[model samples]
Target chain A: MTSDATPALDPAVADRLKRDGNGLVAAIIQQHDTREVLMLGWMDDEALRRTLTEGRVTFWSRSRGEYWRKGDTSGNVQHVKGVALDCDGDALLVQVDQVGAACHTGSRTCFDGRDLPIVTDQSVTTDGDPAALEGDARG
Target chain B: MTSDATPALDPAVADRLKRDGNGLVAAIIQQHDTREVLMLGWMDDEALRRTLTEGRVTFWSRSRGEYWRKGDTSGNVQHVKGVALDCDGDALLVQVDQVGAACHTGSRTCFDGRDLPIVTDQSVTTDGDPAALEGDARG
Candidate 1:
């Protein structure tokens, strides 16, 4: 875990993370309150900068060669709670306060209907579908 | 997070979650030890059933119309620690003990090489990279 009050991340460490073997490090987004992981994406320097500067998570798209910020299009923005680096300084852990659904689907998170089911109210309901991002919403 | 012995989860809730308009939900995998999200995939009832029964996480591939068991091909499997459904029953939280690298790039986890630069031992090093996963020896 990273120290809460550090001047800034080491410039060298930042450089290394950007160059992980595949030219990118996959970002892991987790919920601050629940400690549940919400989504995963690729991140480059710009995305990391935007995430830190903007207080929202951003990722680099190797295919698009662009920055993909959470909620840029969909309303599912992931708020940054904290950031940590592994002992090897080869990975990142982003604690976020996700707003709205983390997945493109209408569900509140991206991991909807994943490992287990949650009971809501008197009835039991499953999570929403994320495919909606490619469906009518885009249309 | 849901308890380890949560009475098998209600079927009605599972059915509702399985219907995310497209009969799939995004399954986000996070590292139980580091709390870093590793990857994102889709899941169906069968996938969920397999994961629950096998003690490893599995998902359905909407693009391929098949079941995807993480580390099936690479040997980097995600061991389940705990699974939780969000309050709305629209998302899931899976705590896992990840093995090897989660990203296809072959790094230890997906959050590697993500543009997080830091100084270590007076040298700058990157995080996860293609080289990290190129010849991962983990089995």
Candidate 2:
């Protein structure tokens, strides 16, 4: 649906995209200065075009099945700082200057305080020593 | 397909996941100290479990239809630093101490030097002034 008949995305840029089965690419938002990941969203060509040229972030809401511009309702604006496509072209990192909360739940970031327990390398000393390797195998 | 008889992921963490149609969640890898995004991968419950307890990053390769552990073949290991789930429980941020290149193309990051042009807020002065707003509308 051509919402406003704005110009399409740059063909050179579009040629690089490797959309998923749903013709969607993952768009990751990060705070420009802090480098903190703010949230993850999906974007199609149209949504990406808007995000790239409108000076704000927009996403194709999978659940809502429609396009939604960030900060339109909640005032949590994401002023675009930069946009980069992954080498595989399946993901985009959109750096922004966030005005307020970046999560739907009003948190500073979607990942804030949501850490999961993970085994770090320091926790397991498998220095290739036969005994340590055997111990790791047993554990 | 339980490859080994290792314990499953923590019940609490497992319950928080919101997998996609492919029974996978997007995992964004970031360099622990630099906070630079390295790459994005997909992980199913099994892959997630392995990553949580294996002290390394693992992903479900959609193209290969199998699980692959990072650095296993490339020798560019991703030593787990931390893992966090988004508020929506549909995405993950995995912080790691990367040993070498994080992309299959042998780049430091999948997104390195792939920036795309984006219009910044400063480019368009929409100060809510009627005249500026009108000008923006025209432009």
Candidate 3:
């Protein structure tokens, strides 16, 4: 169902989306100019429509059960440049001109190198897999 | 729970994840060296396990109700570099060394600038509210 606050979405584009049981699809947000990925959010029909129509990113908050415009509170808005549907139609790639930090922790991207452990040759090979062996040997 | 075939996952890391009602998390795949985002997928515990253990990206196929190793048939394998959990823990950022095209249609990214229409100033204001008017004025 489209949000009452937004205009109707493109029927062809909307029809292609494969929403999950929760009527939500994963929206991968990317910075338009640099193509750096910022974050991933959930978008229902209403959220998608609002985002497409309003020219800013809107997401369906799973916890709050509401439509959240990205910059409404945090002022870290994602000004949308383009929205693309993947071949599977289950996910979306949203290209946006991001302002400020997209991450809640003040990191530029959610995948910033902090919490992520770098995959080393030792970790994969120690587990006793021949494939890991090949991986180690490749290095 | 970690999969039997893979190495034991850190309990702290696993505990942080907020799985959906269907017990799945959104996994964003990116090219490791170049940092280009490729696609998004869904993963359950087993899928995560297989990805780490097998050194390739594996996702839970919702429609087929099975596990799929990317590039197993397509030859577009994603050799993992690292996996990071978002601060919220509901989403994942998987860094990998992508091989060939990440998209089924041979695009480097699932969201390759094909379907996305560039957002120009004209589209938003024609059918918008005062907020959209403000957005237009901001530009």
Candidate 4:
């Protein structure tokens, strides 16, 4: 299905987008596995449509008014895991599996050099293993 | 000198923030090493001051209008690397050295479990190896 599938964006959602200038919301996509942000882009009905259909991340290009696939050329594709809406629904939080570095620059993650520590097993386990106290998280 | 330097917010900066609301801006903190997103929070003059002063991540709670120090209770602290302002100077991109999980739920990163692959060379490497940082970053 395409954005056309939805017929039209919900009026309430459209109203908020109107305040932002048009029927567009900013979507911030992040690498789900690494928690690294891949990219930030705009989304309209059509872009949102392609994202759902293609299984990859797509965005509406405001400057060109065209659909942008995340890795169309760079190969740093973003695979969509889930898309979430902010309380206002005017913004989107896109969770994705990033193929590689998301930025045009040669960085591991779009947030390269941020220098954050790996917190995979802090409280759950002191020795790289999840403790029984934490139980088995389905995740 | 560190994340805890409490400098008076620049007057011009404060004025700009006040014009919009107060000396408050949204800080998008991303993990430096993994490039993962940790969290999104607001920053007022005081929070900004604390972040700069403490050399740790700090944000103003829009809901509470108070300071929020990352990892204060959870040990998922974000060590400040750098701060960038958008053209409007109303938003901040904070690059940090995040310790442990940025999210309260204790995932490796706030973004977890998306599935996209950036095709790369045949030789697979470990997760944090510098050589495999980006797909085409072979050296």
Each prediction's DockQ against the real complex: 0.08, 0.37, 0.32, 0.06
Per-residue lDDT over B13-110 for candidate 2, one digit per residue giving the tens place of the 0 to 100 score: 88999988898899999887788988999999989888877778889988899999888899998877667889888899988889989988988999
Which 10-residue window in model 1 chain B sums to the lowest lDDT? Answer: B130-139
What would the per-residue lDDT of candidate 3 be over residues B55-126, giving only the tens digit for each residue?
677899877889997898988888876677777878888778888999888888886654543334465333
Q: lDDT tens digits, residues A18-130, model 2?
A: 98888899998988778998999999999998987777888998888999977899998887767789988989998888998998888899987777765444454222332
Instruction: Write down the lDDT that model 4 would get.
Output: 0.55
Task: Write the residue-wise lDDT of candidate 1 on A16-113 in tens digits.
Answer: 55344445544657776676666666666556655655566778865567778778788777766555554334345776778887776676555555
- Ranking according to lDDT, highest score first: 2, 3, 1, 4
Candidate 3 iRMSD in angstroms: 5.5
The digit string of per-residue lDDT tens for model 4 on B1-139 reads: 4676545765644554421245455567776656655556667776765664456777766456577787889887787655544433444566777777766667654434321122223433232343332333121
Span of ten consecutive residues with least summed lDDT in model 2 chain B = B130-139
- TM-score for each predicted model, relative to the true structure: 0.46, 0.82, 0.80, 0.48
Give residue A117's lDDT in candidate 4 (0 to 100). Answer: 20
lDDT of every model, 2 decimals: 0.56, 0.80, 0.74, 0.55
Off by over 4 Å in 1: A1-53, A56-139, B1-10, B15-18, B115-139
lDDT of 1 by residue, B1-139 (tens): 7776735534754755623555654465666666666655556666665555556787876547787777889998787655654433434556677888877778765544453322222323234443322221111
Native RMSD of candidate 1 (Å)? 14.1
Highest-scoring model, DockQ: 2
TM match of model 4 to true structure: 0.48
